[model samples]
Target: MSISSRSDKKGGFRRVRFIILAISVFYLAFLQSSVMTFNTAYVVLSNETSSPLFNQYQLGATAALLNMNQFDWSPTYLPLALHRFPLDGLQRSFTFAASFAGGLLGTFPMLYVLKHVGAHVTMSIVGIASCILCALTPVTIAASFELFVGFLAAPIFPVIGTVIEDWAPMEEKGLFVAILSAHVELDTLFTPPVGSLIAEKVNWPTVFYVQALVCAFFTVGWMYFYRDDPGEHFMITRDEVDMIHRGKTKDHLMSPPYRAIFTSLSIWAVFISAIGTIFVGQFMDVFSPQYFTSVLGYSPTITGTLTIIPTIALLPLKAIAGIASDKITRISELAKLRIFNSLACFLGAAFFVVIILVPPSTNSAAATALIMMPFILLAFLSGGFHKAAVMISRQHSSFVYSIVHIFSMLALICSTFTIPLLTPEETFEQWRIVFIIFIAVLTISNIFFIIFVKAEPAEWAHVSNTNEFVQLTEEPRPKHQLRQ
Candidate 1:
C-alpha cells in the first residue's frame, strides 16, 4: 500500500477501535457501577423495614459514629444524631465484601475461559449474567444475586485488556489502556445520582430493574457489533485489519510464569498500588452517598447529583492525561508512571487531609468541590500504576490486570470495614482518624510503587512463538535515558 493509503487506513481503524472500546468499556463499567450503586441506598434500605436485601443483610453492628446507639456505653457523651443501627460501617463493609467473594471465584475462571472461549464470548456471557442477576435482585435472595452480579465484573475487564492489546496501535497502547479505564469513573458518574433518583422517585428495586434494561441494551449491542478478531469484523475493511496488525499485535499468548509474577517486586508494586487506589477510591465512591445523606445532612437526590459531578469532570481530565502520557513519550514510561502515581496518591491523600479539616458547610458547590477533589485526582491512576501493569505484563496483561483487581477487591474490603469501625460516631473527630489512616495507607503504597515500579515487560510475558509482535514503542531517546 502507498504511504498515504496506509495512513488513511490506519486512521479509520483507530477511530473504529476507539469507538468500539468506548461502547464496550462504558457499558461494562456501567454494569459494574450499577451493581455498586446499590449501596447508595444502603442507609435508606437498612432503615426501612427489614428484608433479605436490607436489614437482614446487616446483622451485627448497630452503632454509627455519633448516633444515639452510642449511649449504650457512655453516660456523659452527647449523641450527635439519633439513628438506628445494624447499618454501621462493619455491616456496610461486609456487604461490600460480598462482591469480592464473587470476584475471587471468577478470577481463575477468567483465565480458563479466555484461554478457550475468546474475549467476545466471555464478555457476552458476563454481561448477560449480570443483567440476569440484576433482574433477580428484587427477590428475597437479592444479596445473593448481588454477589453473583459481582462475578460479572471479574472477567470483563481482563477480557477487554486482551482485546485492546490486540487492536490498539503501538504508540497508542498506553493511551488506550488509560482511556478504557475511564469506565471506572464513568460508571460512578452515572450510578450515584441516577441510582439515587430512581430510588427516591420510584423505589430501590426499580433502580436494579432500570440497570437490568440498560445492561441488556449494551450487552446485546456489544454481542451484535463486536468480533473476536479484527479481520472477522464485518464493519471493518481488510485494510483496517491490516493497519491494526501493522501497528501492534499480540498473535499468541503464553502461559504466565507464576513464580516470576509472585516474586517480582515490580508486579507487587502494581498490586500494592491497586490496594491504595481501591481503598481511597471507594472510600469516596462507595461511602460518600451515605456520608452526604447522613453526616452532611443532604437529601439522597442532592447527594447523588453532588457525588457524580466530580467524576464527570474526571473523565475528560483522565483522557487528557492519557493522551499526554502517550504524546510525551521521551521521559521514559517508568518515569511517567512514577510521576503520575505519586501525584495521584499524595495529592489524593492531601485532599483527604484537607477535607478532614474542612469545617462543616452547607454551600453545595464549594463543599462538593472540597469533598470530591480527592476523587477527581484519581484520574492520575490511568497514567500511573494502571498503565504500568499493562506495560509490564504485556501478553500476560490480563492475569496482571486481574491481580490488580484482586488487590483492589481486598483493599476495598479493608477500606469498607475499616472506616465504619474508626468513625462509628461519624463525628468530625472520628473522621479525622479515618482520614489519617487512609492518608498513611496512600503514602506507604506510593512509596513502594515509586521504589519498585517497572515499565518494560517482565521475563514471563514471552509470546508462545516467535511471532515478531511489536514491543511498546516509546519516542526516541538518548542512550543514557533508558533505565536498566
Candidate 2:
C-alpha cells in the first residue's frame, strides 16, 4: 500500500479502537458505580434500621461525643422486623474501616492478577465475585460479610489503571482517565436516590439483589466483548491491530522498576494527594447520608436525592478538566497538572469554608446546595490527579496508581474512625470541625503537589533491559517485524 493510504487506514483504525476502548472503560465504570453505591448506602441503611442487635443509647452516646450539638436520643421505629441490625456510630465506623481494609489488601493481589490473567479476565472474575457478594448480602445479614465483598471488589479498580495504561494513546490519556474517574460521580448521580428508594419502599436487601442481577449481566457482557490487548481481540480489524501495536510501548510487559518507583518524589506526592482526597471523599461516601438525616432532619429519600446534586455538578467539571489537560499538553505536563490541582484544591477549600459557615437551620435548599459545592469543585482535582499518575509512569501506571489507592483506602479506614470521634452526636456544629480539617488537609496536599510532583515519566520507567520507551515520533516498524 502507498504511505498515504496506510496512514489513512491506521487513523481510521485508531478511531475505532478508541471508541471501543472508551465504551469498555465506561462499562467498567458502571460496575464500579454499583459497588460504590452499595458501600455509600450501607451505612445509611444500617443506621435507619432499629434492631435489638444494636444499642440506641450507645449510638446516641457516641454521636453525642462526636457531635456535641442537639441530637434526638430517641430510637427510630423500624418499618420491618428484619431491619433490626445494630449499627451504632462505632459499629458503623468499624464496618466502613473493614471495607477500606479489604480494598487495601487487594492491591498487591490485583497487580499479580493483572499481570498473569490480563485485565479482561481479572475484571471479569472480580466483577462476578462482587456481584455474587452483593446478591448474598441480604441473606448473609452480617456487616463482616459485606466487608468481605468490598475486599473482592477492591482489586477491580487497580486493574482499570492497567488497562488504561496498556490501551490509551499518550495524547488522549487525560480524556480516557477522566471518563473512567467520572464513573464515581456518575454512580453518585443515580445510585444514591435509586438505592435509597429501594431501601425505603421495599427494603435494603432488595437493593442488593437488584444490583447483583445488573452486575451479572454486565459481567458476562465484559467477558464476551472485552480483551486486554487489541491485538488479541477477534473483533478488531488488522488495521486496528497494527495501529495499537505501533502506538504502545514495548516495555509495557517488562519487569517494573520497583526501587526507582518506590523512591520517586513525584510518586510520594501523588500518594499524599490521594490520602487527602480520599479522606474527604470517603467521609462523604460513608457519612453524608447520615449527616443529612441526623443533622439536617431529612428523610432517607430526600438525603439520597440531595447527594445527587454534587455528583451532577462534578461530572461536567471532570470532563472539562480532562479535555483541558489533554489540550494544554503543549505546556509542560507538570505545569498542567499542578495548575489544575492547585486551582481545584484552593477553590474546593473555599467552598468547604462556605459549607462550614452556613448554619444547618439556614434554608434547607440553600444549606444542601452549599454543602455539595465543595465536592463538585474538588472533583476536578481528583480527575486531574488520575491523569497525572498516568503521565508520570505509563508503563508502571497500575502499580503506582494502586499504591496511591491503597493509601487512600487506609485514609478511608482512618476517616471512619475519626469522623465518629469528631462528631459523635451528629450535629452540624460538630461537622463544622470536620470540614475545617478537610480544608486544611486539602490545602496542605495541594501545596505539596504543586511544589514537588513531576508529570514526566520516571527514569526507571524508561530503563528496562529488554524493552525501551517508544517515542511518539519514532517510525513505525515493518508489520512482519512487530512482536505479535
Candidate 3:
C-alpha cells in the first residue's frame, strides 16, 4: 500500500501508537542515560584495572619526574614506560572525539532511513542494534567502540522531532522540546549510581547487558504499541485528535523560510548559546566519574551516585526556563532572557575554575562540594539557554540545531585531544591546567553569544507566514533536505 494510504487507513491505531511512542521515548531517554553512564564508569574502572599504564602511575610518575629530561614526548615512537601502546593515551583521547565525530557523520544515514523506511522503523533498528552492541561487547575497551553506535543513534532526535511536529501544532514545539528534556532528567538522574554499582561489583560489562535488556523490552513495546504520527494511531481520543489537528491548522500553514531563519541574528545567538553549554556538559559527561574517583579520591560508588545531583536539578529548571522563554518572547525582553541565561553559563564555568584554584590542603569534602557546585549551576543554566534556543529555533530549527550540534561536537573533539596532549600525564596538576583552560573556553564561548546573538519578536513565524518557509521547503539545499 502507498504511504499515505497506510497513514489514512490506520488513523485509530496510529493514535494508540503515538501515546505509546511518547512514553517509550521518555523511557528510552532513561536507557540512554544508563548506557552512557555505564560506558563512562566502565572505562574508568577497566582502565584502572586492565591498563598497565594506570597501574604503574606511581612508578612511572616518580621515574619520569626523577629522570625528567630523559623522557620522550615524541609521537614517532611509543614510550618505553607504558606496557600497552605508548599511544594508548592518545588512542583513548581520540576515541572519545572519534565517537562523537562518528555520530555526527552517521546522522546522514539515520536521517535517510527516517525519511525512506520511516521514523519508527529507523529508530527501532538503531535502538535494537545499540542494545545488542551494549550487551555483547567485550571489556570496556571494546565497548567504547559502541560509542559510535550511540553517535549513530543521535539522528533519532530529528526523526522524533518530525513525528512530534506532525502530532503537535507548530506553536507548541517549545512544549514538545521541553517534554523531551524530561527524558534527559531520567537518564541523568538514574544512571549514575546504578551504573556505578554495576561497575563496582559485577564489572562494567554488565551495564551494557542491562541496557540491552531494557532496549529489548522497549523495542518490543514500541513495535507493538507506537505509530509514526497521531494520524496513524488508534489510541488517540477524539478530543486529542481535534487538539492536535487544530494546532497543525493554526500554525501549520506558517512554516518558516530557511534562508530568512538561516540569516537571522537570533538564530546565531541560539546556536552559539547552545554550543557554550554543550562544551561544559560534555566535559561533565565524559570525565565526571573519573575526575571524582581519580582526582578527588572518592570511591566509584560515591562518584556515580553524586553525578546525578545536577541532572536532578535540571528537571525543575527545564520546566521553568521553558515557560520563561515563552514569556520573554518580545524583542525588548530578549536581551534580559539571553543575558540571564548566558550569565548562568559564565558563573558555572567560573565556579569550575574556582575548584581548580582551591589549594590541595583543602578538605576533600570542600573540594567535592566546589566541583559539584559548578555542575549544578551548569545544569540550571542549561535549561534556560536550551529553552531560549528552542523558542528561537522555530525559524530555522533543523539546520540551526544541526549546525549547533556540529560546533559542539567540534569543541568536544578539540577538548578531548588538546587537553590530553597538553597535560601528557594524569597528575592533579595536569587536571588543574585542563580545568583552567576549559573555564576560559566556556567563558569565551558564552561571551561571544552575548555580543552577537539578537532576539527577534517575529523570528519564528517570519518564514512560514511569508513566502520564505514555503520557498525553502520547496527548494531545500541537498545537504539540508530529508533524504528518502
TM-score of 3: 0.69
Worst 10 residues of 3 by lDDT: 1-10
Error of 3 at 246 (Å): 4.7
Residue 115 of model 1, lDDT score: 62
Report clashes for each candidate as comma-separated counts.
6, 10, 20
The C-alpha stretches of model 1 lying farther than 4 A from their native spots are: 1-14, 37-96, 246-252, 293-300, 356-368, 462-465, 469-484
Reference-based lDDT, residue 469, model 2: 33
Top candidate (lDDT): 1
Q: For candidate 3, lDDT tens digit of each residue in 112-133?
A: 5655666567767777777766
Candidate 1 TM-score, true structure as reference: 0.80
Write candidate 2's Cα lDDT for 239-303 as tens digits. Answer: 65544545446666666778888888888788888788878887666788888899888997677
Per-residue error for 130 in candidate 1, Å, reads 2.1
lDDT of each: 0.70, 0.69, 0.56
**In model 2, which runs have C-alpha deviations exceeding 4 angstroms?**
1-14, 19-23, 33-95, 237-247, 293-300, 357-366, 463-484
- Judged by whole-model lDDT over C-alpha atoms, candidate 1 comes out at 0.70
Q: In terms of lDDT, which candidate is stronger, 1 or 3?
A: 1
Better of 2 and 3 by TM-score: 2
Q: Write the per-residue lDDT of candidate 1 for residues 1-484, one digit (tens) a residue.
A: 1122212122234356766777777776776775675665554355533222333344455533234333232123523121223456655655666777888777878767876787788888888888877776654324455577677778766765786676666567767877788777777766766776776666666777788888889999888877766655655553455556653435445567789899999989998988887887886776786777766778966775777777788888888888788889579888999988888899988887777777566454555677788778889888898788877777677777777777777787777678878878776677778778878988999999999998887767644444653221323334343221
Clashing pairs in 1: 62-86, 64-424, 65-424, 65-425, 65-426, 66-425
- Higher-lDDT candidate of 1 and 2: 1
